[model samples]
Target: MQVKTDFNEKQIQILLIAEKLFAENGFEGTSIRTIAKEADINIAMVSYYFGSKEKLLEALIVYRTSDLKIQMENLSVENLDPIEKIDKLIELYINRIRCNKGIYRILHFEFSSEEMEEKMKILNDVRDRNLKSIETIIHEGQAKGIFRKDVNIPLISPTIMGTFFHFSMNKAYFKKLLKLDTDEAFENYIQTTFKTHIQQTIKALLIYES
Candidate 1:
């Protein structure tokens, strides 16, 4: 069966080019005409498909976040022990940044905008559901006696995210700190550290390693 998607070739190209431009330049720096030219499409087509320049930016943000949500959704810890689950979380975190470097750049660079405050409010409306998913996984691990019941998930969830957050959020600083350029080397550091830290975190939590 053939499935229909929201965008056809041209619209997707518009979005792809817009995202790159938006990431390179701030919202104020990018313009609809510029995006149309970059996409090699008619300026009227950009408006026809996306409504307005602001709507196009909103669409780009949605596209980025929805992609992250899909990746998070695809993750499974159903049969894995808590120790393994933690390791999986680490792997997912590092792998996500690796795969979505451009989106990560957008999140890192644009999240501070005043316009994004309202958009973040909308995304925050789903915060409970997202946090609960993490809490449930943590509690399940505890119930199985593979994780510390005393562990504070409220603390841990943010902590795990912080690990990835710092690596991504402070990427420019780290590029200089580590004397590295490009996302690939940054990813290598993450992969190396995740292996070390995940092993240690799980060992400390579970007490016995198998």
Candidate 2:
């Protein structure tokens, strides 16, 4: 599927409702009628726009990731230093997790389902491209002698992805433990502490002395 230029109001509304429903209920558990009622649209409209429940889910994934190619291009922008590029990436990952919060859950849900294999292919390709973008930053740093030559991209990449995912996915536990009951308090923690931590960890790994 093509990366959309942008979605119109109705398309966005349906996708958002689907995202929330899929987050609360598993994909198979949610129904088109439920989405239509919640979204206040006709069932035929949903089918007309997305063709099937599977395509609607695919569209949801695409809507979220439509800017990936642009982000991929950002990795090569000469205006940003290698470290700045890494910061951009860290910011991207953390903020996306922070804002949507449901994206990774839906992604993981697909991974654990046999019915989701075809859908997984599209996401997997996007992931491989993003990984290559990170490797390009490392290569740039190494070229400039700023980053260590022995640094491992594959293993270290997980440090960024895993930590960001873990914190967001487990935020309810964190909120209870930290006693951040309000939305403002929890978001402040993510926008401030959680973001800084990812940036610091990635930088430390990049510049670690051999």
Candidate 3:
């Protein structure tokens, strides 16, 4: 006898199709019928499982956000230096976007959606949590005279994040601009350019403090 899996496959199928549809079409553009058609399920099953379209979208966002939170948690920052922490954050952000192309694409595409006003509120909370972690590391480094105390925590946090964002945001353009299609070339770009920018920024901010 075969043992049954925990999550219902039918529910999983609904979620998978819904995620892709919402990603491709903004939340307002997606509909229950479209999701049902995409999932090859009865239209009524959509309402039965998710209650409403809004709830379905919320579920999809929560699922993706959970994955991101898990990835953020996996980086061991307790014993690392400020610069290393920044590097780890960078690596994590890049890898997260690279690995989950669908989610990142959806996020970028929906960056300015009207629905995002509410979503941004949730993101701000997550960003605040992540920023606090980074802020603590910066403070520790400042105490050790390794990082400049004058550096703006808010500015620094977003600046460090901007590198990964820019890379992923303009991935297609950069890929063509550099004419480097291979993975080795991309790794070199991340290491040489991306890493250099981060290290140099830190050094510039910290090295001159008395």
Candidate 4:
């Protein structure tokens, strides 16, 4: 599905509010009225902007994921080595999810609902495109003899995403375990320590061991 790229400030505000509601309440549980009320607008304005809850969900997904697609496209054209490309990809994915935790949370919650089959298709399509981009980078590495020939391309994305998702979902527990008292400190750990660990994990999976 083609996503609308241009949005006004009011439209973006509505989308952000909807994303937060959807993450906390799930798509089926969130109503247009609720979103409108949260955004301090009338239901008619919500209807005018998105027409319906389903379309709003689609717009939210598109708004959240389109930039990542663009970033991946840009990364594909860079002159970096395959290993460097993978590292950059890891950084991009982590940073994107960190910044947009609400939308990602919505995705995780609504992805398996039987009522959201159509919306899940949109999400799956975006995921497939990203996985294909990662696969391309791995193929480049293998072709250059920089990575192992026996790599399982399909598992790579899940490995990176799943690890982060597990950590993020249980962050409160981990925060106390690690003695991270402030949000800034936890974010610092993610960008530095957690990010480096993921990069190294992917490197170990892809790189050739002589």
- In order, the Cα lDDT scores of the candidates are 0.66, 0.80, 0.67, 0.88
TM-scores for candidates 1 onward, in order: 0.70, 0.85, 0.71, 0.92
Clashes per candidate, residues 3 or more apart or on different chains: 0, 0, 0, 0
Per-residue accuracy of model 3 over 2-93 as CA lDDT, tens digit each: 11123366877787787788778866698899999888888899888767776565555555566566555554355777667666766666
Arrange candidates, best lDDT first: 4, 2, 3, 1
Q: Candidate 1: where is the Cα deviation over 4 Å?
A: 1-5, 65-71, 74-77, 113-115, 120-122, 125-129, 145-162, 168-186, 198-210
Q: Could you give the C-alpha RMSD of every candidate to the true structure, in order shown?
A: 4.9, 2.5, 5.6, 1.7
Q: After superposition, how far is residue 32 of candidate 1 from its true place, in Å?
A: 1.9
Q: How many backbone clashes does candidate 4 have?
A: 0
Better of 1 and 3 by TM-score: 3
Model 4 TM: 0.92
Top candidate (TM-score): 4
Per-residue C-alpha lDDT of model 4 across residues 46-155, encoded as one tens digit per residue: 99988788888888888889889989988976899999999999999999989999998887666776657664567778888898898888888988999999998888
Candidate that beats the other on TM-score, 2 or 3, i.e. the better one:
2
1 or 2, greater by lDDT: 2
Model 4 spans > 4 angstroms off: none
Model 3: how far residue 182 lies from native, Å: 5.8
Candidate 4 local distance difference test against the native: 0.88
